[model samples]
Target: MFGRLRAWSRRHSKLVDALVVSPLVLFCLLTLDVYKSGPPFGRYIGIPATLVLSAALITPLLWRRNRPREVFAVVALVCFAQWVADVTLLPADFAVMIAMYGVAARCTARWAVAAGLVAEFGLLLAVLRWDFSQLDAFPSMSVFVIAIWLAGIYANTRRRYVESLVERAERAERERDQQARIAAAAERARIARELHDVVAHNVSVMVVQADGAGFAIDSDPEQARRAVQAISTTGRQALAEMRRLVGVLRQDAAGGEEYAPQPGVAQLGDLVRQVSDSGLPIGFTVSGTPCALPEGEQLAIYRIVQEALTNTLKHGGPGVRAEVDVHYGRGEIVLRVADDGRGASAPWVEGGHGLVGMRERASMYGGTVEAAPRTGGGFQVVARIPVGVAA
Candidate 1:
């Protein structure tokens, strides 16, 4: 509630100005009457002239916030005129100090510094014209002017320093938001690629197995039973994998009963068996020692192999041979999928999402992939994935 009231008062500063300046005006008017019997106000100006000059000096202070330099000028002029007419000083001379503060706080440093010097001059002129006998007052008056001017300068410096800090903080926040957006978009794209691989490969296998079951059901009951079993197994594996991919999209950090682990090179054997059951001759081999890898890299390795084999099943000619070779080296894991099939004119360009996803995945782990038809005939993808050494 106090904060609200403070903000409201700041917004209605004109009202606050009137409240503050009106008292000074009243004081100066009352002092004009006091001067009638007190000191007669410098032998030249009378009550009427002092009242008029005091009004001109104090009234402009009401607009100090809006036009600080103009107010300062008006106050200076009136004070100088009062000194020339030799009028007595009034309490209303406080307006010049207030105006100097406003100018220092609102205007440039050069103007504020220049106004501070000019304000001391106005003080000296008023003191000399009114009471030269009060020469002991000069040092105190000088200190007051210096202290208040320094305070105004300090306030201006502090305000600009705080504003700079605020601007830097806001800029950092915007960059953080932008980075988050980019990460989200990249994750979405990764999920889409994985989804495509899971759905397309598994569905293709199931479709083929179903056809085989249908054809053999009437003639060879045993073969038809095996085919049907293959379809059911393929369907279950696909469903589990799709669930795992979908689970990653869940923002909840809790790993509950439905949580399924992502696939890695260790799962390559199962994938080979599933694809082999659908009538593709697939072989898996490891050339070097395996290392413990990050979950994301493991997923990438698994998906690249999956997508490559799925493409072979779709595009490789009859009795085509496919192989996956994994090599765990000093600083990286080398994964290669090779197929001795009737390769396309540009085997890498035959599919869209498969090659693009492979590159995106490998690049994430600071790796690279080379996908092209071999000179001896067939397609090959070689990915070198960087990683820390296994413990």
Candidate 2:
């Protein structure tokens, strides 16, 4: 409740200021008669003059927040004019200090200092003219004015400190949100590459089998049956992989059933055999002792190999012979897929998402991929990845 009231008061500061200053304005008007006796002169200014001057001194405070220095200057000028006219001090004189407080709180230090000096000068002049016999009045009023000014300075410092803290907090939140967006975009790109590799390799296999089945449907019934069986198996594998990918996208963990873990180096042999059965003969070889690798690196290696062979199947043309080589070293691993085919000039060798995906995967593991047409014939893809590298 207090927080809400404070917020409302801040928003309606003009109204709050009016309410606070109303009582003071009334008191100054009621006590204007006190000025009739004291001073360098024997009689005060007339009641009408007193009322007009008091209004001039106090009314500008309504605009003090917006024009604090101007308000202070106006009130100080009126006080000076009253002094020049030999009129004694009035309660309305306190408005000069109030205006000084406003200047100290809301204006720059230069203006505040100027206002302070002006107020001090006016105080000295008033004490000399009216209270020279009573030395205590000068010290007491000087302390009170200094206290009000210091309180205003303190308030200004605290307000600026709070604003800086709020700005810093808001900036941190914006940076956090930007980081999250960048991470999310990177994750989406990773998933897109995975889908491309999985779908392209499996679908190319199914297409090869389906075409073979069509060609052998009558003359070689047994070969056609085998082709059909390969197609079914390839389709089922593709469906299962699609399900796993979908499950990964689910917001809830329980939204999808468990699937087999992602394929890695151990599953490369199965991948090669499946492609070989689809009619593109592939020679698979592995050298050096295999060592355990991080799951992400393993996935990168598997996808690189898969994308390479898929490119060969799509672009290698008829009766192409391909080779798959995996060499594990103490510090690194190398993967090479080369196919000798009549379609060596295919565009897949130069540019395609398949090659791009292979390079992206390899790069994640601090590796490089080189895909180009061999000097004699055929296209070759070579990937070298540093072992024990953290991406």
In model 2, pairs of residues that clash are none
Clashing pairs in 1: none
Best by lDDT: 2
lDDT of 2 by residue, 1-391 (tens): 9769988988998998888789878997688666555544434777898888789988899988788888888999999988887776777889998999998888788888888889888989988877778868898889988998898888778878888998999999999999999998988898899889989999999999999999999999999999999999999999888888877778886844678799999999999999999999999999999988888888999898888888888888998999999999878999999999744577554567888888888887789999888878898889999986433
Clashes of 2: 0
The deviation in Å at residue 34 for candidate 1 is 1.8
- Residue-level error in angstroms, candidate 1, position 211: 5.6
Model 1: lDDT of residue 292:
78
TM-score of each candidate structure, all chains considered together = 0.82, 0.87
Model 1, 69-139: lDDT tens digits are 99999898877776676666777778888889878877899999988999998878767766678888988
